[model samples]
Target: MKLGILFSGQGAQKAGMGADLYAALPAYRETIDQASAILGYDLQAVANDEAKITQTAYAQPAILAMSNAIINALGDVLPTPVAGLGLSLGEYSALTASGVMDFNQAVAIIKDRGIYMQTVGEANPGKMVAVMGDDQALIESVLAALQAAGKRVYPANYNTFAQLVIGGVAADVDAAVEALTDAGIQRMVELPVSGAFHTPLLKDAALQLTTRLAGETFKATQYPVYSNTTGSVFTADTLFETLTKQIISPTYFAQALQKMLDDGVDTLIEVGPSDTLIKFAKKIAPKDVKRYAITDVDSFNAVRDLLLAEGKEA
Candidate 1:
């Protein structure tokens, strides 16, 4: 019953998230309070503010704080995972979970990261679109053709074999949508994000984040924490580079999931505000692998009891 955990990223945030847990659990309240102190404002207020919560600057830290609060509420009753991975901004949560970075420091760094990314996005507007299909070759071919034609579009996220996200200049992204539709790939959804994240357009943001991270200290992880940029585990040597490049590099999330599967993680739990990662896991993981999404009180209680029961049975 080896467990692997997935932390929620930026896009998973929603207004009024964590309110139930904050009200019902002492540990959860304590964690959020701690985050609020570090952040210099009330975290709950930001979470309830729809307009502010959607903005990257607040969203990143808020999501991280929420995810960590969920974990704190569960405490040691939850099994210690063999490994963990996060999508984009959630990677900092993974670092915190694994003991590689202090929670306070991680929240602080993410706040700056969010602000830098937002600044870049506003200065150089770009777009991201979720593409759905199974043909990797065809997808790459279209992207290559677009690049050859001088469009800035690039694959931003390899979410699964069935879904890939493309991002770049707004005009180029719109053109890619047309090209993809013409190529008989019609399923696409425009993401509600402020920047062309994981594309070259975020180079400036990455550079700014790099300078910010230079001052932080990282410790050895208690368990392996996978990298979204490299599709593998992070080491002391590659930590800084992988985290910085992740800002502008396409996330190899499917590959990271596969690596965790190969490493014998049969029970996967997603801890965050949304169940999106679990949805992606369903498409990739084998039918036998158990998956759970723990977002709110009901889901958390259900997963906790089930896991404890299963542990007793084992």
Candidate 2:
């Protein structure tokens, strides 16, 4: 089976995300241990602490550590993946798994990236709203109208055909929602996020990340790693630059999924605490295939056993 691996991004993290993974797999425990050492904090402590788990500085590394642990535990049960992609911070997890960035270095860089974004978020204090029940053109029209009106809003995530998320100053986001509602849109909802992620509002954060990214090395990927920024494969030479751009650019998630499907990726395994990526991919492609989310010990074991049995049969 052609496989694609996915790592969860922010907004899906929660306390106790990795407890079952740690308890069921020794390798996963050690992976978290090593990652915690590199991060200078106990990942379990961070994962079990509700408040701390939500903070970007801790959340990014914790999710990375858990996702990597899950990947490590997959071992031979996971055949070489056709492609790997992650949403936002999950990109680092994908890169680490792809061998483009050394695991320890990835942990450090992701932690820093989170801290910088968090700093920028606190200073700017923006809001993100999910606008549904419309096409991208309509979403763009609304944002364009806002921009023309001198509102600070921008498109953040193109999650699906009908779902587009926009972000900016809190007041601007609210105003846009009000305008869209007045325009007869039925499904506009605000997201409870801390920052205007994936928008130019994060340009300052992206610049800080650029300086930090300069000091790191991104090696060639072991597999095709679709980029969220361009919704296409990213080369090693362009990885750092594109990752920097992803901070202030819209995350083309739907396009990236389409890229994987066009590349013949039929099976997708979401490795993280939430099934967000798996659900999103299936919603976009809506094709019948082997798709699953391994979020805990039971889910992990089920996937491992199922795939290992299939391998033997093949």
Top model number, lDDT: 1
Error of 1 at 189 (Å): 1.3
Candidate 1 C-alpha lDDT tens digits along 1-314: 89999999889999998888888889998989999998999998899898999999999999999888888888877788989989998889998989999889998998899999999998989999999999967877998999999999999999998899999999999999999999999799999989899999989999999999998889999999999899999999999989989999999888999999999999999998998988899999999999998888999999889887977988
**Cα lDDT of model 2 by residue, 208-256, tens digit:** 9999988776788899888989888889778878988989999988889
lDDT of 2: 0.87
Instruction: Write down the RMSD of candidate 1 (Cα, Å).
Output: 1.0
Q: What is the alpha-carbon lDDT of model 1 when measured against the actual structure?
A: 0.91
List per-prediction Cα lDDT, in the order shown.
Answer: 0.91, 0.87
Q: Candidate 2 has what TM-score?
A: 0.98
**Deviation from native of the Cα of residue 101 in model 2, angstroms:** 0.6
- For model 1, what is the alpha-carbon lDDT of residue 196? 94
Model 1's TM-score against the true structure: 0.98
